[model samples]
Every structure is written in C-alpha cells, then in structure tokens.
Target: MRSLIVTEFMSLDGVIDSPGGGSYPHAGWTFKDVQMDEAAYDIKGREQQEAGAMLIGRVSYDEFAPVWPTMEEFAEYNAMPKYVVSTTLTDPQWHNTTVLRSLDEVAELKQGEGGPILVHGSATLAQGLAAAGLVDRYHLLVFPLLLGGGRRLFATEVADKQRLTLAEHATYRNGVQLAVYDVLR
Candidate 1:
C-alpha cells in the first residue's frame, strides 16, 4: 500500500490557514511574519523530491493549479500526478489531474501502487482523512508565531483518538521547526 502524507506550514497555535497568502486576514504570514533563512525551505524541496504524486482538496487545487505549473521550483509537483478531491469540480485544466468525489476514493488510491501521495494546503481534506484514519503520515513545518484564529489542521471534535509517533524533527535557526510524524494504525 502507498503512503498518504499531509504536509502543511502551521502556526504555533495549530493554525494552518493562509500560510502562503489567501483571503485570510493574516495571509502570507509564513513569509511576511517570519524572515527565515533559505535553509528553512529545504524541507519543502525535499518533500517535492520525495513525493511521487500530489493530492489536494478543491480549494488547494484551485489555488495551486493556476500558478504552480508556471513556477520553475514546483516543476516536480507540476509533473507528478495530481488528485483533487471535489464533488463540484467537473473539469480540471492542469495536466495529469484527476478529480476524486470522496474520501473513499482517496482511501482506494492509497491502497494502489505508488510512492507517497503528498498532500499540501488541504486543511478540510486533511481533517477528514485524519478522522477517517486514512492519513499515513504528516510533515508539519511549525512556525513560532500564533495567529490564535484560523482554520486548524486538526479538528476540535474527534470521534476517536488517533495515535501518532514522531519519526523525525528539526529546528531551524529562525525558530521554525519540522516535525515528521507517522500515524499509528
């Protein structure tokens, strides 16, 4: 079975919204609020290199599909197979893109043959996958600041407790921390 990895740039208070600038009030906080060294982004590069396919929710797919393909840094992601979980999305313009209707399809995808399906900027989708016990791993880049209010990676009300084991961790000079955890089944 393939691994499903959810990666995010989160705040100290567990806020995962608008790290790269969106409609949120604290948009672009990841770069605007923190002035981290280039090394801090090495983890992102590694994720792109290691990921075999990319999976995202409709919102993230809409946000990324327009720009990532043109950017040279996101070439790996642009080239990889992209799956967007959406019930409304009928046509996807991005190359090698597929729209999945539900989390069950995502679960099926995880069982198929492939490398890790890296998920980026899909808070709702991640939460659903986590609650459904479909997520296999998580790569979180936790920033030092806290926004206090925003959508979080983990939901407040969970039906059951999910256990996770810390696989690796690293702290950057700018106080950004990388926490890699494997979801225990």
Candidate 2:
C-alpha cells in the first residue's frame, strides 16, 4: 500500500502556521538564509523522488495551485498526481489535479500502488487524518526559534492518543532539525 507522508516546517514551539509570507508575525522566518549544506537538498530531493502524489486540503491547494505550476523548481510536483480534499473545491485548474471530497476517498488513494501520498500545509486536514489514524509518516523540520502564538502542528483535535516512533533524525548547522516519525498503532 502507498503511504501518506506529511512534511512540514515548524518553529521550536511547534507552530506550523505560515512558514511562508502570510499574516503570522514571524511569517517568513523559515526561509531566511540559514546555513544549509548538500544534506538539506538531499532530503528535499528524496521526498520529491519518493512522492507519487500530493494530498492536501483546500487551504493548501489554494496556496499552491497559483504558484507551484509556474515555478521551474516544483515541476515534479506539478507533473505528479495532486489530490485536494475539499468540500467546496469543485474545479481544479492546475494540471493533474483531482478533488477528493471524503476521507474514504483519501484512504482509497492510499491503497494505490504508488510511492507515497505527500501532504504539505494542511493543518486542519492533518488533524483529521491523525484522528482517523491514516497518517503513516511525519517529516517535521523544526527551526531554532519559537513563534509562541501561531497555529501548532500537534493540536488536540485528535480523537485519541496516538504514539509515534522516531524513524529518522538529522540536524543542520543552522539549527534546523529534521525528525521523521512513524505513527504507531
């Protein structure tokens, strides 16, 4: 079965809201020029190579649809199958985009013989997927600073306690730590 992998950048305080430019006070903190080597690029390259499709919520889809298709760097993601889980998203103008309205549909997509269903920037959808025990892996890149006031990644919206096992860990010179966890059943 294909895996549902979540990848997000967060502050030390677990704030995953608006890593890019947005309304958050420390919005663009993540992209600031920190010392990153080839290992960092390797991680990103690996994720893209392993991803068969991308699973995202309406908010993420809205954020990405307009910009990603235009970027030469994200051509791989644009070419891959993209699934947006939304009730209101009726038409997707981006190439290879598909709107999935239900959790069942998301689950069904996971059963496909693909590499991985990569999910990014879907906080509410991540919570829902966590509650349903559908998230297979979480790749969290934790920055050195603390936001103290933005939306958190591990919220209490989950229905029950779910444990996680650390599968991978890597630390960057600029204090960004990549922690990969497997959702334990």
Error of 1 at 54 (Å): 0.6
Over 4 Å off in model 1, which ranges? none
lDDT of 2 by residue, 3-93 (tens): 9988998888888888876777777777763554556546667888889999899988988898989999888898999999999999899
For model 1, what is the error of residue 158's alpha carbon versus the real structure, in angstroms, after optimal superposition?
A: 1.5
Per-residue alpha-carbon lDDT of candidate 1 for residues 1-185, written as tens digits (9 for 90 to 100): 99999999999999999898789999999999998678878888998998889999999999999989999999999999999999999999999999999999999999899789998988899999998889999999999998999999998888889899999999998899999999988
Candidate 1 to truth, TM: 0.98
In terms of TM-score, which candidate is strongest?
1
In candidate 2, stretches whose alpha carbon ends up further than 4 angstroms from where it belongs are 33-38
Which pairs clash (backbone N, Cα, C closer than 3 Å) in model 1? 21-28
CA lDDT of each candidate? 0.92, 0.85
**Residue 67's lDDT in candidate 2:** 90
For model 1, the local distance difference test gives 0.92
Model 2's alpha-carbon lDDT is 0.85
